[model samples]
Target: MDSGVELKKFGLPSQCCECGPQKSPALCSAIFATSICPNCFGMSVTPGTRYHTLLNTNEPPDESELTFVRSVASTVDASLEYLDHEIANLPENVKRLEEKRASLLSYRVRNNAILSPLRRIPPELLREIFSWTMPSLEGTAEVALCIEQTPWMLTQISRRWRVVTFSTPSLWSQIFIDYRHSHINRDPSTYSPSLMKAQLDCAQKLKIHFYGSQGIDLRPQIDMFKLLSQHSSRWEELSVELTAEMVPILMTLRDRIPSLRRLWIQWSTVEDQTGVHSIDCFQTASSLVDVGIFNDYRFVPVLLPVHQLTRYDMDCQLEEHIRILKQTPNIIEARIDIAFDEEVGSDSLETVDLLGLRRLYISPAGVLKYFKVPALEELALDIYGEDILSLVRSLLDRSSCSL
Candidate 1:
């Protein structure tokens, strides 16, 4: 007997209805008995075989194939039940794997945090790093109080940062605030008077840069000023823009401010340009080194111990500048914004030689003709009028300045 035709002894069909030419067929589920297994096919499951042809078509079989067809169906149904049980477990298996993956990710993050260099740094060094984030109040930008500012923001980052920020005095030393918030109807959240008080309390010595509206005065502003004035002895640097009404309040600082080194004051009024309100509060600032007074119209006047000043800035007439410059013989740097040139003959005027002056700035051309600064190294001139170069050259030649 031929080996390929051996399965025919079981009287099985030779052709499958799946492919008409009876290509290589399979009986993947052929056996159904005590053990339902495909291997019980008794021959290889291939094309042109009895079980392959019947199972592929699943059509009504001839009477001779009826028994074999029912056997294949029972075996397929059992295999489907096994697959149904496995499919039902898929969701739980996926959920368990996902939870395991999340746990590993969390563990990795915590491990990395433990190894971070910042955790191992000294607290003093870490606090110094935080202090570098403090803002430099250069013009009027810091005049408005905002909780979002860097110094205030540092306190909110974490418990460690908040503790470090509170201990660093330089972070709180610069207190800049405009007492004119009520004019704009600003939100209370935009600034905090109590926070300013807390800042003053935090720093040992303070640099107070205060500003306010030109005309309007509020009780809160007065109270804040008074509160700051109480610490006059601790003021290292003071800059303010004041009106006539604030003059008496500043007079309270007389015989009070001793640590004051740098002072700048601006008159905050346009209505009373001719009215000069003088306060001798800063005359007691014996340690005062640098003074800046913008004498636009002299509405608010101040007195400083000018003899000891190294740097002086004033917007004044030529005679007034010479008068003040004579007093400040120690002045090394001076910015004179000439209000108007005096008509005095050059021969009548004594050539004022600023012996130690190294840096000089002046405007409107004629002030240089009066100054003989032998030590002048840098000269900034806002030149006007004809023969300005000749005027500068005359200043350099007679003074023998290196500028």
Candidate 2:
């Protein structure tokens, strides 16, 4: 036979069982064996296996492919076993380590807490820290919890922080319970007393603010004042803004709080013109060295009995205050509120009759005409709605003639 005809007669066709005469077969398998055609066998196992076990023909494995496959299989097996062991032990190990870290932190905090450092510092230095932490006047808003909000920064650092916060009386002092801007409206009855007592115990100065709450009847003020009266000796300063009707309850506190030094009793800015009659609360602040009374022209004369006051401010009929200046002997500083006129007159000069007065502030329309001012040191005059040059000229003339 011819050479080509004899080769075709002996050769096997390239088709496989997996290919099934449709597509190229990378592999074909049975229970006993897996076979790949020479064209596709590279896709299945390596050439090394082909020579050793797969093929009855004479082709052999490429040595490089055999070495790569053996190394890959060993690595894959080792990785799987190692991953299993790591997954099995991870959670328990994490829990144990977390517990140990928590214990260590707790020990560190307790050992290094604020109390020890606080105790070691001198009392004067401690007082300065107390002063530094004290809250400034927060206008009409509710007092924000500056230290309480920053508990983590100071308190969580060590055991000493907690001790210092609790032990330092000055730190806890000056609790401002401003019911005006608080959520106190939701349950006023239940909440007011508790806050009052807590603040009273912790603070030496108390500021009870009542902002924009018409619903807060006088009963709450009375109750809180009663509670504060119980701790009167510690109450050093008080700033109260209440309805004109709450004056009675506040006056009850005057005798009880022997330690009270400063008292500010004023009406609401919004509720300025509500009541026809004015009530006086200043007479009760006997220990008061500073007082501010806000009233209409018709209401200021009744409070002149508080003559022992060091500082006094009144928004009332300025002419009516002449009687007050005539009576109160030790008036150090006085601010009298009244409309002024340009004309220099005897009545206007008589208004500042506090002979021992050191500081005097008069309003825009007030005319200081004639007076015997012996100890008058600082005088402030507000001259509005008038000819500025003429007013100054008349003042200079009067000042020269008086001298």
Candidate 3:
């Protein structure tokens, strides 16, 4: 018979020989049982010479050629059957290697933990080192963002470090709360409550600096103020910028802040001129001394016990500064920015003697002539106006203070 024509009639194997051994055997066996013998199907061998010659000469293949093909098919099928059994065990080998790797990693971690030098440092010294990591107050925004990071990062370093960082009250005492810096987009409630409680728990005395920004939600700011007010007795030094809506929240701390000493308040907006015109929050704060008021002209009238202040800083109209100086005779140092309004005329104003004042920083050099600082030693004036020298000479003459 013609081999080419017979091969076409028998057809090729249904599955590839390269397939994994499990599927290959059944497919190979079925192909071998068919008219195509196993040898031709598995090895894909060329047919005998008679089959090759038949293409050119039209000769038929003898029975011997058919017998040889049958024998080869049987041997090839046996080899495939054995190989399929070996391939099935590969998954188990892979799993064993993975388990070995995991065990090694676990051992390495345990060994490294035992040898870590950081664990050897004493708790006291470690706390001191953590204290040094605190950011300085040069940049308010940067300091505010880093506040949450300093104590948090130290605690995460190790269990021992966590204990040390939490125990150190000074690390948490100076808190910088900037609504614009870190929590610009997040709701303040997310981090405020837990952070405030944690700080309060760790610190005995708090120096809180709250920096506000425009367009932020008022609720969070008000909430923070309310929370802080609850612990007003622990407030040692507080510097906060308030919007019109948040002004009332601050006023709630009136007569309650007995421990307040240094106070700094700034108004973010001027729309509600009458709202904070009289801030009596620290009216009963006997410990209050150093005071800095920015952008709020009405702040001076409401501050109680101004006579006890040792340092004062304010940006207000000329007459208001004079009014404040008249009340604060005990002030040792004063920084005043004079805004010349129509009400502040060159008409002779009363001479207020600051008998105890040592340092005076006043804007508009001419305004110095109006003050009588008898003990003033250090003077920094924003030198302007035509008769600055005459003003200085006149002030020195009136006070008899050596410049």
Best by TM-score: 1
Instruction: Give stretches of model 1 more than 4 Å off.
Output: 1-107, 139-143, 180-184, 215-217, 272-275, 299-301, 340-347
Error of 1 at 56 (Å): 7.2
Residue-level error in angstroms, candidate 2, position 195: 3.5
Model 2: number of clashes?
A: 11
lDDT of 3 by residue, 1-403 (tens): 6543545433433334455434543465464443333444425423453444443465655776566445445656665675576578778878898999999999999999899887798888887888889877777655643334787778887777888888888888887777766546455554456677778888888898886666677677777777777888889999987777767777888777888899988766666445445777787898999998886544435565788899998877887777778988689999988763644436668778899999999886767767898899999989755477778888999999997
Error of 3 at 328 (Å): 2.3
Model 1, span 1-403: residue lDDT tens: 4412644533333433343344322432232221234333434366655566665776566797566557556766776676687689889978998999999999999899889887777879977887777776764555455678867788897777788788888778888866544633454234476887788777888898877555454555666778889898999998887755656688888889999999888766665344554668888788899999887764244677889999999886666677778888899999988764456335666667799999988876666788889998898888666488898889988988767
**Residue clash pairs of candidate 1:** 24-47, 25-46, 25-47
Q: Which stretches of candidate 2 lie over 4 Å from their true place?
A: 1-127, 144-163, 172-175, 186-192, 204-212, 268-286, 296-306, 339-358, 370-380, 389-403
Candidate 1 vs 3: which has more TM-score = 1
Query: Largest lDDT belongs to which candidate?
Result: 3
Cα lDDT of candidate 2 equals 0.53
Give the higher-TM-score candidate: 1 or 2. Answer: 1
- Quote each prediction's TM-score: 0.75, 0.58, 0.66
Full ranking by TM-score: 1, 3, 2
What lDDT tens digits, residue by residue, belong to model 2 across residues 147-247? 34322134454465555554555555564544455466564554346644554565545444333245555567556655655675666676666555555
Give the distance in Å from residue 22's predicted Cα in candidate 2 to where it truly belongs.
62
Candidate 3 lDDT score at position 140: 61
What is the TM-score (0 to 1) of candidate 1? Answer: 0.75
